[model samples]
Target: MSLAFSERARAEIDRLLARYPTRGAATLPVLRVAEREFGGIDDDVMVLVADTLDLSPAQVRGVFSFYTHLRRPGWGKYVLQVCATLSCALRGCEGLADHLEARLGIRAGQTTPDRRFTLLKVECLARCGESPVLQVNDDMYVNVTPAKADAILESLP
Candidate 1:
Protein backbone atom coordinates (compact mmCIF):
# COMPACT_ATOMS: atom_id res chain seq x y z
CA MET A 1 0.00 0.00 0.00
CA SER A 2 1.17 3.51 -0.78
CA LEU A 3 1.33 6.20 1.90
CA ALA A 4 -0.91 9.22 1.70
CA PHE A 5 -0.49 12.60 3.36
CA SER A 6 -3.06 14.48 5.35
CA GLU A 7 -4.26 17.83 3.99
CA ARG A 8 -2.11 19.67 6.52
CA ALA A 9 0.96 17.66 5.63
CA ARG A 10 0.39 18.35 1.93
CA ALA A 11 0.21 22.07 2.64
CA GLU A 12 3.40 21.95 4.68
CA ILE A 13 5.17 20.01 1.94
CA ASP A 14 4.13 22.64 -0.58
CA ARG A 15 5.49 25.40 1.64
CA LEU A 16 8.73 23.50 2.14
CA LEU A 17 9.19 22.95 -1.57
CA ALA A 18 8.67 26.63 -2.24
CA ARG A 19 11.79 27.41 -0.21
CA TYR A 20 14.00 25.46 -2.62
CA PRO A 21 14.62 26.36 -6.24
CA THR A 22 14.00 22.81 -7.32
CA ARG A 23 11.37 20.46 -5.95
CA GLY A 24 13.94 17.67 -5.83
CA ALA A 25 15.96 19.74 -3.38
CA ALA A 26 12.97 19.60 -1.01
CA THR A 27 13.32 15.84 -0.55
CA LEU A 28 14.42 16.20 3.05
CA PRO A 29 11.49 18.40 3.98
CA VAL A 30 9.10 16.13 2.16
CA LEU A 31 10.50 13.15 3.99
CA ARG A 32 10.03 14.94 7.30
CA VAL A 33 6.45 15.73 6.42
CA ALA A 34 5.81 12.14 5.45
CA GLU A 35 7.42 10.90 8.64
CA ARG A 36 5.32 13.22 10.76
CA GLU A 37 2.14 12.20 8.96
CA PHE A 38 2.78 8.46 8.81
CA GLY A 39 5.01 8.14 11.88
CA GLY A 40 7.95 6.69 9.88
CA ILE A 41 9.39 6.35 6.39
CA ASP A 42 8.46 2.90 5.21
CA ASP A 43 9.00 1.56 1.69
CA ASP A 44 5.48 2.55 0.71
CA VAL A 45 6.08 6.11 1.87
CA MET A 46 9.32 6.28 -0.13
CA VAL A 47 7.47 5.33 -3.25
CA LEU A 48 4.72 7.76 -2.43
CA VAL A 49 7.20 10.59 -1.98
CA ALA A 50 8.98 9.66 -5.19
CA ASP A 51 5.68 9.71 -7.03
CA THR A 52 4.69 13.00 -5.46
CA LEU A 53 8.01 14.65 -6.36
CA ASP A 54 8.41 13.00 -9.78
CA LEU A 55 11.54 11.15 -8.63
CA SER A 56 12.37 7.48 -8.68
CA PRO A 57 12.27 5.08 -5.74
CA ALA A 58 16.06 4.65 -5.96
CA GLN A 59 16.55 8.40 -5.72
CA VAL A 60 14.24 8.71 -2.73
CA ARG A 61 15.81 5.76 -0.92
CA GLY A 62 19.34 7.03 -1.60
CA VAL A 63 18.62 10.35 0.05
CA PHE A 64 16.69 8.71 2.85
CA SER A 65 19.56 6.40 3.80
CA PHE A 66 22.10 9.22 3.63
CA TYR A 67 20.38 11.36 6.25
CA THR A 68 20.20 10.30 9.89
CA HIS A 69 17.21 12.54 10.49
CA LEU A 70 15.07 10.40 8.20
CA ARG A 71 13.94 7.62 10.46
CA ARG A 72 13.00 4.32 8.80
CA PRO A 73 11.28 3.06 11.92
CA GLY A 74 9.13 4.75 14.52
CA TRP A 75 10.79 6.16 17.64
CA GLY A 76 9.58 7.52 20.93
CA LYS A 77 8.40 11.11 21.41
CA TYR A 78 11.77 12.19 22.83
CA VAL A 79 14.91 11.26 20.91
CA LEU A 80 18.01 11.92 23.01
CA GLN A 81 20.98 12.02 20.66
CA VAL A 82 24.30 12.32 22.49
CA CYS A 83 27.44 13.39 20.66
CA ALA A 84 29.94 10.55 20.91
CA THR A 85 32.88 12.10 19.09
CA LEU A 86 36.37 12.53 20.56
CA SER A 87 35.67 15.94 22.08
CA CYS A 88 32.41 14.87 23.66
CA ALA A 89 33.95 11.62 24.88
CA LEU A 90 36.80 13.55 26.51
CA ARG A 91 34.26 15.74 28.28
CA GLY A 92 32.71 12.77 30.12
CA CYS A 93 29.81 12.16 27.70
CA GLU A 94 30.11 8.43 28.26
CA GLY A 95 29.55 8.90 31.96
CA LEU A 96 26.51 11.01 31.25
CA ALA A 97 25.23 8.39 28.83
CA ASP A 98 25.67 5.74 31.53
CA HIS A 99 23.74 7.87 33.95
CA LEU A 100 20.91 8.28 31.46
CA GLU A 101 20.82 4.56 30.85
CA ALA A 102 20.77 3.78 34.56
CA ARG A 103 18.13 6.34 35.30
CA LEU A 104 15.90 5.47 32.34
CA GLY A 105 16.62 1.74 32.43
CA ILE A 106 17.21 1.80 28.71
CA ARG A 107 20.61 1.51 27.02
CA ALA A 108 21.76 3.55 24.08
CA GLY A 109 19.87 2.65 20.88
CA GLN A 110 16.88 1.55 22.94
CA THR A 111 13.65 3.16 24.05
CA THR A 112 12.21 3.38 27.50
CA PRO A 113 9.66 0.76 28.61
CA ASP A 114 6.96 3.42 28.59
CA ARG A 115 8.04 4.37 25.05
CA ARG A 116 8.48 7.99 26.03
CA PHE A 117 12.14 8.36 25.11
CA THR A 118 14.89 6.83 22.97
CA LEU A 119 18.60 7.22 23.63
CA LEU A 120 20.90 7.37 20.60
CA LYS A 121 24.68 7.64 20.48
CA VAL A 122 25.26 9.96 17.55
CA GLU A 123 28.52 10.90 15.82
CA CYS A 124 28.77 14.66 16.34
CA LEU A 125 26.36 17.47 17.09
CA ALA A 126 28.98 20.04 15.84
CA ARG A 127 29.42 21.63 19.27
CA CYS A 128 33.09 21.00 19.95
CA GLY A 129 33.44 24.11 22.07
CA GLU A 130 30.47 22.94 24.08
CA SER A 131 31.77 19.45 24.47
CA PRO A 132 29.40 16.81 25.77
CA VAL A 133 26.50 18.04 23.73
CA LEU A 134 23.15 16.38 23.31
CA GLN A 135 20.05 17.03 21.21
CA VAL A 136 16.70 16.20 22.68
CA ASN A 137 14.05 16.33 20.01
CA ASP A 138 14.80 19.67 18.30
CA ASP A 139 16.67 21.40 21.14
CA MET A 140 20.39 21.17 21.75
CA TYR A 141 21.85 21.01 25.24
CA VAL A 142 25.56 21.55 25.62
CA ASN A 143 28.33 21.21 28.21
CA VAL A 144 26.36 18.54 29.95
CA THR A 145 27.44 16.88 33.16
CA PRO A 146 25.76 13.79 34.60
CA ALA A 147 23.93 15.97 37.06
CA LYS A 148 22.73 18.30 34.32
CA ALA A 149 21.69 15.35 32.20
CA ASP A 150 19.75 13.88 35.11
CA ALA A 151 17.98 17.18 35.63
CA ILE A 152 17.20 17.47 31.97
CA LEU A 153 15.76 13.99 31.78
CA GLU A 154 13.80 14.55 34.94
CA SER A 155 12.30 17.68 33.48
CA LEU A 156 10.97 15.87 30.42
CA PRO A 157 7.27 15.16 30.27
Candidate 2:
Protein backbone atom coordinates (compact mmCIF):
# COMPACT_ATOMS: atom_id res chain seq x y z
CA MET A 1 0.00 0.00 0.00
CA SER A 2 3.01 2.23 -0.27
CA LEU A 3 2.84 5.19 -2.60
CA ALA A 4 6.58 4.68 -3.08
CA PHE A 5 7.36 8.25 -2.25
CA SER A 6 11.08 8.78 -2.81
CA GLU A 7 13.52 9.27 0.03
CA ARG A 8 13.95 12.89 -0.97
CA ALA A 9 10.23 13.42 -0.79
CA ARG A 10 10.07 11.72 2.60
CA ALA A 11 12.82 13.94 3.91
CA GLU A 12 11.04 17.01 2.53
CA ILE A 13 7.79 15.94 4.18
CA ASP A 14 9.57 15.47 7.48
CA ARG A 15 11.10 18.90 7.20
CA LEU A 16 7.74 20.40 6.32
CA LEU A 17 5.97 18.60 9.17
CA ALA A 18 8.49 19.94 11.69
CA ARG A 19 7.49 23.49 10.79
CA TYR A 20 3.81 22.88 11.45
CA PRO A 21 2.09 22.07 14.76
CA THR A 22 -0.42 19.65 13.26
CA ARG A 23 -0.33 17.19 10.36
CA GLY A 24 -3.30 18.98 8.87
CA ALA A 25 -1.28 22.18 8.87
CA ALA A 26 1.29 20.38 6.74
CA THR A 27 -1.29 19.12 4.25
CA LEU A 28 -0.40 21.47 1.40
CA PRO A 29 3.33 20.85 1.65
CA VAL A 30 2.75 17.13 1.84
CA LEU A 31 0.57 17.27 -1.24
CA ARG A 32 3.26 19.30 -2.99
CA VAL A 33 5.78 16.61 -2.19
CA ALA A 34 3.41 13.98 -3.51
CA GLU A 35 2.85 16.00 -6.65
CA ARG A 36 6.57 16.30 -7.28
CA GLU A 37 7.10 12.62 -6.66
CA PHE A 38 4.14 11.32 -8.62
CA GLY A 39 3.88 14.08 -11.24
CA GLY A 40 0.25 14.64 -10.17
CA ILE A 41 -1.97 14.00 -7.16
CA ASP A 42 -4.13 11.28 -8.69
CA ASP A 43 -6.50 9.08 -6.72
CA ASP A 44 -3.80 6.73 -5.54
CA VAL A 45 -1.55 9.57 -4.49
CA MET A 46 -4.43 11.14 -2.59
CA VAL A 47 -5.06 7.91 -0.68
CA LEU A 48 -1.41 7.53 0.12
CA VAL A 49 -1.06 11.14 1.19
CA ALA A 50 -4.09 10.74 3.43
CA ASP A 51 -2.55 7.65 4.98
CA THR A 52 0.67 9.53 5.63
CA LEU A 53 -1.15 12.47 7.19
CA ASP A 54 -3.77 10.39 9.06
CA LEU A 55 -6.51 12.19 7.14
CA SER A 56 -9.20 10.89 4.81
CA PRO A 57 -8.66 10.60 1.08
CA ALA A 58 -11.69 12.80 0.55
CA GLN A 59 -10.01 15.52 2.60
CA VAL A 60 -6.83 15.19 0.59
CA ARG A 61 -8.83 15.24 -2.64
CA GLY A 62 -10.63 18.39 -1.55
CA VAL A 63 -7.35 20.19 -0.98
CA PHE A 64 -5.69 18.76 -4.05
CA SER A 65 -8.56 19.77 -6.30
CA PHE A 66 -8.66 23.27 -4.91
CA TYR A 67 -5.19 24.35 -6.03
CA THR A 68 -4.29 25.12 -9.63
CA HIS A 69 -0.52 24.89 -9.04
CA LEU A 70 -0.94 21.18 -8.43
CA ARG A 71 -0.52 19.21 -11.58
CA ARG A 72 -3.21 16.86 -12.82
CA PRO A 73 -2.70 14.01 -15.23
CA GLY A 74 -2.02 15.09 -18.79
CA TRP A 75 -0.68 18.50 -17.82
CA GLY A 76 2.00 19.38 -20.31
CA LYS A 77 5.64 20.08 -19.43
CA TYR A 78 5.04 23.80 -19.86
CA VAL A 79 1.81 25.05 -18.26
CA LEU A 80 0.91 28.47 -19.61
CA GLN A 81 -1.66 30.13 -17.38
CA VAL A 82 -2.98 33.36 -18.86
CA CYS A 83 -4.53 35.80 -16.44
CA ALA A 84 -8.22 36.28 -17.14
CA THR A 85 -8.97 38.53 -14.21
CA LEU A 86 -10.64 41.93 -14.45
CA SER A 87 -7.41 43.88 -14.79
CA CYS A 88 -6.00 41.65 -17.46
CA ALA A 89 -9.35 41.28 -19.18
CA LEU A 90 -9.69 45.06 -19.39
CA ARG A 91 -6.26 45.15 -21.03
CA GLY A 92 -7.08 42.80 -23.88
CA CYS A 93 -6.37 39.47 -22.14
CA GLU A 94 -9.20 37.97 -24.17
CA GLY A 95 -7.56 38.94 -27.42
CA LEU A 96 -4.22 37.62 -26.21
CA ALA A 97 -5.89 34.35 -25.28
CA ASP A 98 -7.49 34.15 -28.69
CA HIS A 99 -4.13 34.78 -30.28
CA LEU A 100 -2.57 32.01 -28.23
CA GLU A 101 -5.28 29.57 -29.26
CA ALA A 102 -4.80 30.39 -32.91
CA ARG A 103 -1.03 30.20 -32.70
CA LEU A 104 -0.85 27.02 -30.63
CA GLY A 105 -3.71 25.38 -32.50
CA ILE A 106 -5.28 24.37 -29.20
CA ARG A 107 -7.90 26.03 -27.07
CA ALA A 108 -7.48 26.92 -23.44
CA GLY A 109 -7.54 23.93 -21.05
CA GLN A 110 -6.04 21.76 -23.73
CA THR A 111 -2.53 20.50 -24.39
CA THR A 112 -0.80 20.58 -27.72
CA PRO A 113 -0.55 17.30 -29.60
CA ASP A 114 3.20 17.33 -29.06
CA ARG A 115 2.62 17.60 -25.30
CA ARG A 116 4.96 20.60 -25.07
CA PHE A 117 2.43 23.06 -23.76
CA THR A 118 -0.90 23.36 -22.03
CA LEU A 119 -2.75 26.67 -22.33
CA LEU A 120 -4.92 27.59 -19.34
CA LYS A 121 -7.09 30.62 -18.83
CA VAL A 122 -6.70 31.30 -15.14
CA GLU A 123 -7.77 34.04 -12.77
CA CYS A 124 -5.49 36.79 -11.47
CA LEU A 125 -1.83 35.97 -11.08
CA ALA A 126 -1.56 38.87 -8.60
CA ARG A 127 0.12 41.13 -11.15
CA CYS A 128 -2.76 43.48 -11.83
CA GLY A 129 -0.54 46.43 -12.66
CA GLU A 130 1.11 44.26 -15.26
CA SER A 131 -2.03 43.38 -17.10
CA PRO A 132 -2.15 40.68 -19.75
CA VAL A 133 0.19 38.47 -17.78
CA LEU A 134 0.80 34.80 -18.27
CA GLN A 135 2.88 32.32 -16.36
CA VAL A 136 4.89 29.66 -18.08
CA ASN A 137 5.97 27.18 -15.49
CA ASP A 138 7.52 29.37 -12.74
CA ASP A 139 8.20 32.42 -14.89
CA MET A 140 5.65 35.19 -15.36
CA TYR A 141 5.59 37.49 -18.34
CA VAL A 142 3.78 40.78 -17.99
CA ASN A 143 2.28 43.20 -20.47
CA VAL A 144 2.43 40.63 -23.19
CA THR A 145 1.29 41.33 -26.72
CA PRO A 146 0.45 38.72 -29.36
CA ALA A 147 3.84 39.07 -31.03
CA LYS A 148 5.59 39.00 -27.69
CA ALA A 149 3.66 35.90 -26.70
CA ASP A 150 4.64 34.18 -29.90
CA ALA A 151 8.28 35.11 -29.33
CA ILE A 152 8.08 33.80 -25.79
CA LEU A 153 6.73 30.49 -27.01
CA GLU A 154 9.43 30.25 -29.58
CA SER A 155 12.11 30.94 -26.98
CA LEU A 156 11.10 28.08 -24.74
CA PRO A 157 13.49 25.17 -24.82
Candidate 3:
Protein backbone atom coordinates (compact mmCIF):
# COMPACT_ATOMS: atom_id res chain seq x y z
CA MET A 1 0.00 0.00 0.00
CA SER A 2 1.07 3.52 -0.74
CA LEU A 3 1.28 5.43 2.53
CA ALA A 4 1.13 9.18 2.81
CA PHE A 5 2.10 11.23 5.83
CA SER A 6 0.05 14.19 6.95
CA GLU A 7 1.58 17.54 5.96
CA ARG A 8 2.41 18.37 9.53
CA ALA A 9 4.07 15.00 10.01
CA ARG A 10 6.05 15.42 6.84
CA ALA A 11 7.19 18.86 7.92
CA GLU A 12 8.13 17.63 11.38
CA ILE A 13 10.04 14.68 9.95
CA ASP A 14 11.88 17.01 7.62
CA ARG A 15 12.83 19.22 10.54
CA LEU A 16 14.01 16.23 12.58
CA LEU A 17 15.93 14.81 9.61
CA ALA A 18 17.74 18.11 9.26
CA ARG A 19 19.11 17.80 12.80
CA TYR A 20 20.71 14.43 12.17
CA PRO A 21 23.84 13.67 10.12
CA THR A 22 22.33 10.48 8.63
CA ARG A 23 18.90 9.08 7.96
CA GLY A 24 19.65 6.18 10.30
CA ALA A 25 20.45 8.69 13.02
CA ALA A 26 17.11 10.37 12.39
CA THR A 27 15.08 7.16 12.74
CA LEU A 28 14.08 7.56 16.41
CA PRO A 29 12.87 11.13 16.25
CA VAL A 30 11.07 10.50 12.94
CA LEU A 31 9.42 7.51 14.56
CA ARG A 32 8.32 9.74 17.46
CA VAL A 33 6.63 12.04 14.96
CA ALA A 34 5.02 9.00 13.37
CA GLU A 35 3.88 7.75 16.76
CA ARG A 36 2.13 11.03 17.54
CA GLU A 37 0.60 11.20 14.06
CA PHE A 38 -0.52 7.57 13.89
CA GLY A 39 -1.63 7.30 17.56
CA GLY A 40 0.57 4.25 18.20
CA ILE A 41 3.31 2.25 16.51
CA ASP A 42 2.37 -0.83 14.47
CA ASP A 43 3.64 -2.61 11.36
CA ASP A 44 1.90 -0.16 9.01
CA VAL A 45 3.24 2.73 11.06
CA MET A 46 6.71 1.14 10.91
CA VAL A 47 6.46 0.91 7.13
CA LEU A 48 5.57 4.57 6.82
CA VAL A 49 8.36 5.58 9.18
CA ALA A 50 10.79 3.32 7.32
CA ASP A 51 9.99 4.98 4.02
CA THR A 52 10.28 8.42 5.55
CA LEU A 53 13.69 7.66 7.05
CA ASP A 54 14.84 5.56 4.08
CA LEU A 55 15.25 2.57 6.39
CA SER A 56 13.97 -0.95 6.01
CA PRO A 57 10.72 -2.05 7.68
CA ALA A 58 12.77 -4.48 9.74
CA GLN A 59 14.98 -1.66 10.98
CA VAL A 60 12.05 0.43 12.12
CA ARG A 61 10.37 -2.54 13.75
CA GLY A 62 13.56 -3.45 15.54
CA VAL A 63 13.85 0.00 17.03
CA PHE A 64 10.23 0.03 18.07
CA SER A 65 10.50 -3.35 19.75
CA PHE A 66 13.69 -2.42 21.55
CA TYR A 67 12.09 0.66 23.05
CA THR A 68 9.35 -0.81 25.21
CA HIS A 69 8.54 2.59 26.66
CA LEU A 70 7.12 3.82 23.35
CA ARG A 71 3.37 3.61 23.06
CA ARG A 72 2.03 0.50 21.38
CA PRO A 73 -1.14 -0.16 19.43
CA GLY A 74 -4.27 -0.19 21.66
CA TRP A 75 -2.53 1.88 24.35
CA GLY A 76 -5.02 4.04 26.24
CA LYS A 77 -5.01 7.82 26.52
CA TYR A 78 -3.31 7.45 29.89
CA VAL A 79 -0.56 4.82 29.91
CA LEU A 80 -0.18 3.92 33.58
CA GLN A 81 3.15 2.21 34.11
CA VAL A 82 3.97 1.22 37.66
CA CYS A 83 7.64 0.58 38.37
CA ALA A 84 8.31 -3.07 39.16
CA THR A 85 11.98 -2.86 40.00
CA LEU A 86 13.42 -4.41 43.15
CA SER A 87 13.28 -1.18 45.12
CA CYS A 88 9.74 -0.53 44.04
CA ALA A 89 8.68 -4.10 44.72
CA LEU A 90 10.11 -3.92 48.21
CA ARG A 91 8.06 -0.81 48.81
CA GLY A 92 4.62 -2.24 48.07
CA CYS A 93 4.61 -1.71 44.31
CA GLU A 94 2.92 -5.07 43.95
CA GLY A 95 0.03 -3.87 46.08
CA LEU A 96 -0.04 -0.66 44.10
CA ALA A 97 -0.18 -2.59 40.85
CA ASP A 98 -2.93 -4.78 42.22
CA HIS A 99 -4.88 -1.79 43.34
CA LEU A 100 -4.57 -0.20 39.91
CA GLU A 101 -5.72 -3.40 38.23
CA ALA A 102 -8.69 -3.72 40.54
CA ARG A 103 -9.64 -0.09 40.22
CA LEU A 104 -9.28 -0.02 36.43
CA GLY A 105 -11.00 -3.41 36.07
CA ILE A 106 -8.16 -4.71 33.93
CA ARG A 107 -4.95 -6.57 34.67
CA ALA A 108 -1.50 -5.25 33.99
CA GLY A 109 -0.65 -5.12 30.26
CA GLN A 110 -4.33 -4.55 29.47
CA THR A 111 -6.28 -1.44 28.53
CA THR A 112 -9.68 -0.57 29.94
CA PRO A 113 -12.67 -1.06 27.62
CA ASP A 114 -13.14 2.69 27.36
CA ARG A 115 -9.45 3.11 26.47
CA ARG A 116 -8.91 5.70 29.18
CA PHE A 117 -6.16 3.78 31.00
CA THR A 118 -3.64 1.08 30.10
CA LEU A 119 -1.89 -0.53 33.06
CA LEU A 120 1.66 -1.90 32.76
CA LYS A 121 4.47 -3.11 34.98
CA VAL A 122 7.66 -1.36 34.00
CA GLU A 123 11.27 -1.25 35.21
CA CYS A 124 12.83 1.42 37.40
CA LEU A 125 12.00 5.07 36.91
CA ALA A 126 15.46 5.83 38.52
CA ARG A 127 13.86 7.39 41.59
CA CYS A 128 14.64 4.47 43.85
CA GLY A 129 14.39 6.67 46.93
CA GLU A 130 10.82 7.30 45.92
CA SER A 131 9.69 3.76 45.38
CA PRO A 132 6.22 2.92 44.08
CA VAL A 133 6.44 5.38 41.22
CA LEU A 134 3.68 5.45 38.65
CA GLN A 135 4.04 6.96 35.24
CA VAL A 136 0.90 8.32 33.56
CA ASN A 137 1.52 9.22 29.98
CA ASP A 138 4.72 11.32 30.23
CA ASP A 139 4.40 12.39 33.84
CA MET A 140 5.91 10.44 36.69
CA TYR A 141 4.33 10.35 40.12
CA VAL A 142 6.82 9.31 42.74
CA ASN A 143 5.94 7.95 46.16
CA VAL A 144 2.64 6.76 44.79
CA THR A 145 0.03 4.98 46.83
CA PRO A 146 -3.28 3.45 45.81
CA ALA A 147 -5.19 6.47 47.08
CA LYS A 148 -2.83 8.95 45.42
CA ALA A 149 -3.01 7.01 42.19
CA ASP A 150 -6.81 7.17 42.19
CA ALA A 151 -6.70 10.86 42.91
CA ILE A 152 -4.28 11.35 40.02
CA LEU A 153 -6.65 9.56 37.67
CA GLU A 154 -9.61 11.67 38.79
CA SER A 155 -7.61 14.85 38.20
CA LEU A 156 -7.14 14.05 34.52
CA PRO A 157 -9.47 15.78 32.09
Candidate 4:
Protein backbone atom coordinates (compact mmCIF):
# COMPACT_ATOMS: atom_id res chain seq x y z
CA MET A 1 0.00 0.00 0.00
CA SER A 2 1.16 3.53 -0.66
CA LEU A 3 1.95 5.72 2.32
CA ALA A 4 -0.29 8.64 2.95
CA PHE A 5 -0.08 11.98 4.66
CA SER A 6 -2.21 12.96 7.63
CA GLU A 7 -4.98 15.51 7.12
CA ARG A 8 -2.88 18.33 8.54
CA ALA A 9 0.01 17.43 6.31
CA ARG A 10 -2.29 17.25 3.30
CA ALA A 11 -3.52 20.76 4.05
CA GLU A 12 -0.01 22.01 4.43
CA ILE A 13 1.03 20.34 1.21
CA ASP A 14 -1.84 21.94 -0.59
CA ARG A 15 -0.83 25.36 0.67
CA LEU A 16 2.77 24.77 -0.36
CA LEU A 17 1.80 23.57 -3.80
CA ALA A 18 -0.24 26.73 -4.31
CA ARG A 19 2.82 28.81 -3.55
CA TYR A 20 5.13 26.96 -5.95
CA PRO A 21 4.61 26.74 -9.68
CA THR A 22 5.28 23.02 -9.85
CA ARG A 23 4.69 20.11 -7.48
CA GLY A 24 8.40 19.35 -7.68
CA ALA A 25 9.12 22.80 -6.33
CA ALA A 26 7.18 21.86 -3.20
CA THR A 27 9.24 18.73 -2.56
CA LEU A 28 11.30 20.05 0.31
CA PRO A 29 8.36 21.57 2.15
CA VAL A 30 6.36 18.40 1.65
CA LEU A 31 9.23 16.37 3.00
CA ARG A 32 9.37 18.54 6.07
CA VAL A 33 5.64 17.99 6.58
CA ALA A 34 6.17 14.26 6.32
CA GLU A 35 9.05 14.42 8.77
CA ARG A 36 6.94 16.29 11.30
CA GLU A 37 3.96 14.02 10.75
CA PHE A 38 5.85 10.74 10.69
CA GLY A 39 8.75 11.69 13.01
CA GLY A 40 11.35 10.97 10.29
CA ILE A 41 11.72 10.47 6.55
CA ASP A 42 12.10 6.74 6.08
CA ASP A 43 12.01 4.75 2.84
CA ASP A 44 8.24 4.63 2.73
CA VAL A 45 7.95 8.39 3.19
CA MET A 46 10.51 8.93 0.44
CA VAL A 47 8.35 7.00 -1.98
CA LEU A 48 5.29 8.92 -0.91
CA VAL A 49 7.10 12.21 -1.34
CA ALA A 50 8.26 11.25 -4.82
CA ASP A 51 4.74 10.26 -5.79
CA THR A 52 3.37 13.47 -4.35
CA LEU A 53 5.86 15.62 -6.22
CA ASP A 54 5.64 13.64 -9.47
CA LEU A 55 9.35 12.86 -9.24
CA SER A 56 11.35 9.67 -9.03
CA PRO A 57 12.35 8.17 -5.70
CA ALA A 58 15.97 8.91 -6.56
CA GLN A 59 15.16 12.60 -6.89
CA VAL A 60 13.47 12.81 -3.52
CA ARG A 61 16.22 10.78 -1.90
CA GLY A 62 18.86 13.10 -3.35
CA VAL A 63 17.14 16.14 -1.87
CA PHE A 64 16.60 14.39 1.45
CA SER A 65 20.22 13.32 1.74
CA PHE A 66 21.39 16.86 0.95
CA TYR A 67 19.81 18.30 4.08
CA THR A 68 20.96 17.19 7.53
CA HIS A 69 17.83 18.55 9.15
CA LEU A 70 15.80 15.81 7.44
CA ARG A 71 16.42 12.64 9.43
CA ARG A 72 15.97 8.92 8.98
CA PRO A 73 15.21 6.10 11.41
CA GLY A 74 17.08 5.61 14.71
CA TRP A 75 16.15 9.14 15.58
CA GLY A 76 15.60 9.46 19.31
CA LYS A 77 13.43 11.75 21.37
CA TYR A 78 16.26 14.28 21.20
CA VAL A 79 18.80 14.51 18.37
CA LEU A 80 22.07 16.19 19.33
CA GLN A 81 23.88 17.41 16.21
CA VAL A 82 27.29 18.82 17.06
CA CYS A 83 29.38 20.91 14.70
CA ALA A 84 32.38 19.08 13.29
CA THR A 85 33.63 21.97 11.18
CA LEU A 86 37.03 23.62 11.69
CA SER A 87 35.80 26.29 14.09
CA CYS A 88 33.97 23.87 16.34
CA ALA A 89 36.69 21.25 15.95
CA LEU A 90 39.39 23.74 16.96
CA ARG A 91 37.24 24.64 19.94
CA GLY A 92 37.23 21.01 21.13
CA CYS A 93 33.89 19.84 19.68
CA GLU A 94 35.37 16.43 18.91
CA GLY A 95 35.79 15.84 22.64
CA LEU A 96 32.24 17.03 23.11
CA ALA A 97 31.03 14.43 20.62
CA ASP A 98 33.03 11.79 22.42
CA HIS A 99 31.70 12.90 25.78
CA LEU A 100 28.11 12.64 24.59
CA GLU A 101 28.72 9.22 23.04
CA ALA A 102 30.16 7.90 26.29
CA ARG A 103 27.50 9.50 28.43
CA LEU A 104 24.60 8.44 26.19
CA GLY A 105 26.14 4.99 25.59
CA ILE A 106 25.83 5.42 21.83
CA ARG A 107 28.49 6.34 19.31
CA ALA A 108 28.18 9.25 16.96
CA GLY A 109 25.38 8.68 14.36
CA GLN A 110 23.70 6.12 16.61
CA THR A 111 20.66 6.37 18.81
CA THR A 112 20.60 5.29 22.43
CA PRO A 113 19.02 1.88 22.96
CA ASP A 114 16.41 3.46 25.19
CA ARG A 115 15.41 5.81 22.33
CA ARG A 116 16.13 8.89 24.44
CA PHE A 117 19.03 10.43 22.54
CA THR A 118 20.86 10.37 19.20
CA LEU A 119 24.31 11.85 18.74
CA LEU A 120 25.43 13.10 15.33
CA LYS A 121 28.57 14.91 14.22
CA VAL A 122 27.49 17.43 11.63
CA GLU A 123 29.37 20.00 9.50
CA CYS A 124 28.54 23.64 10.39
CA LEU A 125 25.73 24.89 12.59
CA ALA A 126 26.16 28.51 11.37
CA ARG A 127 27.49 29.78 14.73
CA CYS A 128 31.22 29.57 14.18
CA GLY A 129 31.90 32.08 16.94
CA GLU A 130 29.96 29.87 19.30
CA SER A 131 32.24 26.96 18.69
CA PRO A 132 31.44 23.62 20.27
CA VAL A 133 27.85 24.27 19.35
CA LEU A 134 25.21 21.60 19.05
CA GLN A 135 21.58 21.67 18.13
CA VAL A 136 19.23 19.50 20.15
CA ASN A 137 16.56 19.16 17.54
CA ASP A 138 15.66 22.77 16.64
CA ASP A 139 17.08 24.49 19.71
CA MET A 140 20.80 25.24 19.64
CA TYR A 141 23.09 25.15 22.64
CA VAL A 142 26.25 27.15 22.05
CA ASN A 143 29.57 27.12 23.89
CA VAL A 144 28.85 23.65 25.20
CA THR A 145 31.47 22.07 27.38
CA PRO A 146 31.27 18.50 28.61
CA ALA A 147 29.89 19.64 31.95
CA LYS A 148 27.37 21.94 30.34
CA ALA A 149 26.32 19.24 27.91
CA ASP A 150 25.80 16.77 30.73
CA ALA A 151 23.77 19.33 32.63
CA ILE A 152 21.70 20.10 29.55
CA LEU A 153 21.03 16.46 28.83
CA GLU A 154 20.15 15.83 32.47
CA SER A 155 17.71 18.70 32.39
CA LEU A 156 15.83 17.31 29.41
CA PRO A 157 12.66 15.41 30.11
lDDT of 3 by residue, 118-144 (tens): 999987888899988999988989999
Instruction: Please estimate how well model 1 matches the true structure, expressed as its whole-model Cα lDDT.
Output: 0.86
- Residue 7 lDDT (model 4): 85
| CA displacement after TM-score superposition, residue 45 of candidate 3 (Å) | 0.6
Question: Against the true structure, what is every candidate's RMSD?
Answer: 2.2, 1.6, 1.8, 1.5
lDDT of 1 by residue, 1-157 (tens): 5357889988898888889998889998899889878888989999999988989999999999766566656577789888888999999999988888888898899988777888988887889999899889888999998888888878987
Weakest ten-residue segment in model 4 by summed lDDT:
65-74
**Backbone clash tally (model 1):** 0
TM-score top scorer: 4
Which pairs clash in the backbone of model 1? none
Candidate 2 TM-score to native: 0.90
Cα lDDT listed for each candidate:
0.86, 0.90, 0.88, 0.89
Which parts of model 3 have CA positions greater than 4 angstroms off?
none
lDDT value, candidate 4, whole model: 0.89
Residue 32 of model 2 has an lDDT of: 81
Work out the TM-score per prediction. 0.84, 0.90, 0.88, 0.92
Q: What is the lDDT of candidate 2?
A: 0.90
Candidate 1, after superposition: displacement of residue 110 in Å? 1.1
Q: What is the lDDT of residue 115 in candidate 4?
A: 86
TM-score of 3: 0.88
